[model samples]
Target: MISQVRSELTRYLRTETVGGAILLIAAATALLWVNSPWGDSYFTMTETVLPIAPLHLDLTLADWTKDGLLAIFFFVAGLELKRELVVGELADPKRAALPIIAALGGVATPALIAFVVGFGTDGMDRGWAIPVATDIAFALAVLAMTGSRIPASARVFLLSLAVVDDLVAIVLIAVLFTSAVSLLWLLAAAACFGGWALAQHRRISSPVIYVPLALIAWYALHEAGIHPTLAGVGLGLLTRVRPDEREDQAPATRLEHLIQPISAGLCVPLFALFASGVPLDGKVFGQLFTDRLSLAIILGLLLGKTIGIFGISWLAIRLGIAERPADLGHRDMFALSVLGAIGFTVSLLVAELALADVGDGSAVELAKAAVLVTSMAASLIGSALLLRRGRVHRARHEARALQPEE
Candidate 1:
């Protein structure tokens, strides 16, 4: 029995979705622990002072995870964006149209809904971008809970949609979220991108060589009124090697593979732990059912996300622009569409941006609480529906197989 149980545990661990599940669990655990009676200690530990060189950087341990560790997360996101543009789904326009179109609708609808909900409010309007994100880790966790039930195309569709979602989220952060604009520094960043492009064109093989220049670019953008992280995307986009005529490519794919493990294993999880820490105490629970930003976020994810994703997807299929996977029908798509709102990671990132210049942490905390609640609810409902749908699909298939004559 012990050997059998160990073997089963090993099999579960080997599953692709299991890692995502573990990450979500870790995030939830961190949130719970940080909000408990030991919460003050948790806060202190995260906020403890640490110095690097002459500059002393002090942040709650959470801030380090958010600002410091999340750089690596964005770096990996940059890598993924590069890969998708080069050789993955985003490479070909024809194949990419469906998800891209659906993603646009998905992103736009949520933002619009958020704005509509917060219309009369002053500062709350800035948080329009909060609900427009889809957390890939949580979404993947939803998919993985299905075991073998989810079709390959559905999985691909979800991933492709998320790629486009991430793209839009990046643009929103760079454009709408930033306060001031610095033309001179922006020009310098542009020049750095141009240089990186030239190196990629010339088959430059040194990642080390780009480090200082990238940092310079980062500083330029940071000073230029753009978020420093946008530079990561810009640098990634500029330096990424396209899979064209060259026989031996430079550092693109190799760098991507090397970074994926770090991103998935450490950076992302740490980000999750930091980002997910919304103190869910008595006051927070009260706000969950009443606060405008919280209500907007919750309703946007619960109602708008499903409508946005499924509504656009239905239109696409109706217009013959795209079709669902063979193993997936409208019912299955609805099930999957519900999961689209599990916007934990991306929502938190956007929340950070939305609440950047606002009142200290209140808006961020409200957004986090909403995201946490709605995303958890979406994941649970979506998972249950998909599992049942999968079982029904299997039963119908088996019944047809057993039929002697039609």
Candidate 2:
């Protein structure tokens, strides 16, 4: 059973690697479409509204991608978090402390840098959360391409840190961005969550029964003025992580197995398509360096994230609050920290939420462009560092293998 589970995880990681490449393609396509002669049509398609009058669910194509499809991604994320907290690497209090501490640093430093950079700038301060995210798919893909000699522990560390980063981003979205709340609908959403938990406790395995309940919870949360993607997190946490003695796999594991491909392939790519379509003309490029918002995002992601994650991690290890993995060195940790700055997916979502109420979308456009450019820059820098490190590790391993026998 353990081997089988490992096999599944390996497959999932491979799929995510491919999915990351596809996501880049999708984002590039969106950018091209938006900047092409037919750019207005791209806007028109995204803005076309579809409304379910009875449920008060009205959304555009872009909204569906963000609020609807991205829920699948968050649900998968929540499942991963639950597994880690319950029986995975993070199951141990000591093992979890390092990544948790580093993730907090990762979140705080970027927000502080962004706030300081955008403090006096108009409408830029709202996007303080923009650099606090790390695109797991893209980062992992870059790591995988860095070569096979990279320590497995490095990947594990990166995954744990990214999960915590996502958790922080979710909280920011729920608390910092929400403008209003409706108690009645919020209560309804909570009730739905209760029912979902009850069903999980009862060992209800049928998707038919749970699907409608999930939709109801989503709708209620939407009406409650909370980001409905959070409904996915709530349901996922409530999933059963431990199987009954008679069963081989837990419900959460099974659900993750079923949903991960969908989330990676369809939902995330679709979200990237809609969310990354910034019209990058000459004016946007000219303002990329001069604009406070762009500078904040660039510095926060490129400089602040690297410094924060690595600095806090080093502090934690030095103080004996956390232990570095035996297989990983300071350089490896620093490379992973650089990868943490590739904050594409959630950062773009936060930029949209932050600038939603602003009349003109110039600030929004600038933020989106910054996220794209900075993420790419981080990826390149991280990949270079990891590649060099991988070669050194590989050479050391080969040298050890060639040592004289006793």
Candidate 3:
């Protein structure tokens, strides 16, 4: 059982790591495409609208990428979170408390920092939530690629921190972005969710049963003005994790294994390709320092995320509220905290939702640019720290291997 579990984790990590690389390449391509002489083509491509009259949805390619494609990513996130809560690190309250507190700190501190820096600014009210998310896919990808000798428990800790942090961000997104709630549609969405839970209870594992229900739920939530992505999360969380006597894996595990690649490779990269193409110029660069919104986002991701995640974790361990995972040291914990600063996927989405109301699109562009720049820097710095720590771990492993039998 242990070997099987480890194999599953290895598979998950491998998929996410490859996906992260694709996501990065896609983002880089977006940057270059948007700046090329034919830059208008990039904008045109994202701006092109597809009319779904039957569903009463007419959305741009970018909107589909953000609202639609990213929903799959969130679904995968929900599955991971549910699995963690049920059988993973979060299964034990004692084990769970550290990352939970750290996640809260991660959210609170960066938001506080952004609020302070961008106080009285136009988008600050909504934009402060920008840095609260840690893109688990990207962050774990970095660890998988760079921290070869790092303990599995360290990866587990980072995953827990990021999953919990992203959960909070999702709640904030749902609350802060809802313009108006249609009661009827909300009721319909609720009905769908109810049916979903019922299906799970009855052990109905057919895709035919789930796919239509998920689609209807998504549509209902969209019409209800509560970001439809919540549908994916709700469905994912509802999926059963414990396999039956004759089953190899639970529905949740099976579904995650199937959909993770699609979410990571296609959904996320496509979203990044559409979302990361912020028209590059001197004005955008200038605003990184002079503009309060941009500066606030940058500082919040870099300094605030580091301070909040690492500080709370240290305090928790010292207070004996939670035990640190074995084979992980303070230096390792610190490096993991820094990795929490890599906010990419949902950060860009929040940048869109937060600044959508403003007539001037420049603020939105600047905010995203800040996110891209900050995430890149955090990845580099965190990777370096983790790599150094990894070498120490490798040496320790080698020493253990060389030791004589007792």
Candidate 4:
């Protein structure tokens, strides 16, 4: 039985696309089950306190997932983002422009729209920033199941765009969301970052050397009024392996490879399980549709994302800043843009920040419900459209290929 379980685990891990999908499914199921008749137990399970020596640490299962497990996800994300900036498509200014432009436009337009809609409401206006994040796991999963049919360039474009989106989201979280400023704690955090840098300079690649420093950095940031997870970004940027002088080889490539599986395989899956399970019960249904925050999120993610990505992309192509991707014309881009509307994880994180301790406690719940609903709708609609378009495009290409006489 142990051997059988090991074999199954190996298979599940091997299929990255399937693994992501399964994780998402598990999250949704957990949410539904917990919100249903078993909700009391589910709620209790999350709220149950787990203890360590001399420290009374309290968390709901949800907090453990978000505050703890999701940090690992962000760490992995930081790793990937760094690698791309250093060596991948994003490394090249020319190649990176199209996606960077689209991502910026995508982010800017949505926030603008949200602000307009939520105008005159002081902090409620702040929530516009929440819809700006694109959940990379969900996006990648959508792309992956579509298989090799997508142009490699489009996939690269989407990945780069999402990375930029995450960057923007991080900045907004740090600047806009933070309420209190603790100078001493921030100084300590800086000291921890400096120590982490020193260790990296000495080429200490083991996670052990970094882990204690990371913990300190996290605690410091927590105290310093910055969200603790941003420490992952700090730790990632500071640590590095030297670049290979040989053009044929990569410097940080191995490190990236080493951490990616852990990030994608374990950390991300756990995050999906933890971050995603909102109690989607009958009570949630009323709040999901009518709440101002919920309405704004749903519309922003569904309408704002689709329009922003596609609209800006078209303008860039028209203005000659970018050429239409060789295999993808406007129609294809539109379909993908809709898929980009699937905002899940980052949206949740932003909602948590936006509604932190705000009145009625219902705003955050409503936002989560909106995220869950709109993201699912966006994914389904986007997938159906892409599959149809891909089929047609494939048929056309195959016909051209077969027409040898021409």
Candidate 5:
């Protein structure tokens, strides 16, 4: 019975729609829980501190989910990124140019818009980074549900763009969030990376060894004042993706298969539960539109993402710098841009880091609310557009099928 339940859960977790559906449910539960009459309990649960005295670690429930569970999600992201760089869509310069360019355009325009709007605002410095990330799981979920008649290359394009966006977000976290560094601890983290790479090179696959090593690396990065999540990315990239002559799968593939279900079904959803519990009062709603910080985030996501992604993609294709996916039209690309605007996971993480030092936690809360609002709006708009475009493609396919094979 237990194995049957486990098998069912694994199947569910492997589905694109299921992961995103669970994430949305988690976020909604958090929102409702924080606003209910028992709201104090929600706050209490998230704020309660847990300390590991030996390791000098003291963190709240929210922090643990963000710092620990979210790291696993990033680890899966890192593995996908490494796979792409080594053997997937991003392996060739000619094939890679379109998504890479779109990703850059996506990042730059949102940042520029946010900075321009919130130039003199207190959290502007960090808040500008929030809308630059595209939540891969969420975007892919919408695609799978609404774009069944679309070409497979559309999914490839979206995944590649999101992966590059993840890389940019990682760099930003490492560069912007670390205010001070302990060199000795940093060196310890580096040593951990060395050991991880060595393990990969030697084909050592013991969980006992790698698990503790990963924990130590995370701790070292935390002590070094770096965002400890980068440890997951580092270790994931170092894992071998190519299979040996006698092997069915490489270490990266095995780890990803083991870890991704846990990440999608548990880790990411838990982080959303903890991190997305912001209070949604009338004052917050007013601030979302009137306040520069929230306004910047919303506009950056809605406008910056749409114009940047679609515009750059069109130009690249027209100039012959990049090839367009066969049978997809300008309308489909526009829909993709709108979908790309749904920046949920990494955007929320950025909101926390960016406004962590801002006054009274209000800025952080507002930034998060803006992300949520923008993501919802993008999802709705993009889904509608995709559904309409899908019908057109479906009609074309049906018409072609009805005609005699010629």
Candidate 6:
């Protein structure tokens, strides 16, 4: 059972690593498209509005990428979270406490830092949530590249931390960023979720039944003024985690296997393509440096994330509230904490949401640029640290292997 779980995790990591590479390429393409001669076309394409008046749905291409495509990504995330909680590392209370505590610390510290840095600055304080996110795919890609020699326990810990971080980000999006609430639509969404739970309880396995229900729930949430992507999480959590006696596979696991590829390969990269394209002009460049919002974001991600994650994790171990994995040393933990600083996908989403009503597009553009710059720097610095740690770990392994038999 343990080996099977490990194999599944390895497979998932490999898929995410490849997806991260594609995401980077997509982001680069967006940057290039925005800076090229056809820059106006890129903006035009994303800003083009499409409406389905009958359904009362009206959104731009960029909005669809964020609200529609990213739901697939969050659905996979919810599956992983449920798996961890139900049968994986987080199933054990003692084992779960570390990453859960670490995740909370990670979120709180960055948010606090952003708030402090942007305090009293116009339109800047709203972006406190931006630095609180950790991009799992991108961070995992860095780990795959630099820390392959590290133990599987490190990967497990990182995955757990990232999952919890995403959950917090989702809550922040639902609560802090929501503009208004329509109680009727909210109740309708609740009914859809209840129906979803009922279907799962009855072991109804037909997509024909569930898919439309999911769409209705998503639409209801959109109408309720909450981020509709949350419907994905709701449906995913309602999925059955225990294997049927006959099939020996949980519904959550099965659905994850089917949908993960779509989320990682298509939805995420598409979202990045639309989200990362910011027009670069001299004015934007100047704003990137001078703007309080940008500076708060950069510092919050680069410095605050590392400090918060590492500090809280250390405190947890020191206080006997959590125990570090035996295979991971203090050095490895610190290195992983540094990697946690890579806040790209969700951070970009938060920046857009937080600053949407604040100013002209320039502030949003600057915020996006800050996220790009900080995430890149975090990737480089964290990768270098992990590479150094990996080499040390490999050397230790080799020395032990070379030792004479007892």
How do the residues 317-405 of candidate 6 rate in per-residue lDDT, one tens digit apiece? 99999999868999999999998999999999999988887767777888899999888888898888888888899999999999999
- Please give, for residues 118-234, the per-residue lDDT of candidate 5 as tens digits: 999997877899999999878888887888778777887888899998999999999989999999999999998999888888888898879988998999999999999999899
Question: By TM-score, how accurate is candidate 1?
Answer: 0.87
Give the distance in Å from residue 189's predicted Cα in candidate 4 to where it truly belongs: 1.8
Worst 10 residues of 5 by lDDT: 4-13
Indicate which candidate wins on lDDT: 3
- Model 2, 1-406: lDDT tens digits are 4465455557657877877888888899999999999999989988989888887778998999999998889998888888778776688889899999999999999999999998877666568888999988888888888845788878778888998899999999999877789999999999999999999988889988799989999989999999999999989989988889988888988888789889888899889999888989889999999988899999999999999999999999999999997688999899999999999889999999997766588888889999999999998999899989999999899999999999
**C-alpha local distance difference test of each model:** 0.74, 0.88, 0.90, 0.73, 0.88, 0.89
Per-residue lDDT of candidate 4, residues 122-156 (tens digit): 35757898778787778778877763576655666
C-alpha RMSD (angstroms) for model 1:
5.9
Residue 126, model 6, lDDT: 64
- Candidates sorted by TM-score, descending order? 6, 3, 2, 5, 4, 1
Better of 1 and 3 by lDDT: 3
Query: For candidate 3, lDDT tens digit of each residue in 85-162?
Result: 887778889989989999999999999999999999998889999999999888988988888789888887888888
lDDT of 6 at 206: 95
Q: Per-prediction TM-score, please? A: 0.87, 0.97, 0.97, 0.88, 0.96, 0.97
The list of candidate 5 runs beyond 4 A from truth reads 1-16
| Cand. 3 TM to true fold | 0.97
| lDDT for model 3 | 0.90
Tens-place lDDT per residue, model 1, 345-373, is 76887787777667777878888889988
What C-alpha lDDT, on a 0 to 100 scale, does residue 119 get in candidate 1?
69
Stretches off by above 4 angstroms in model 6 are none
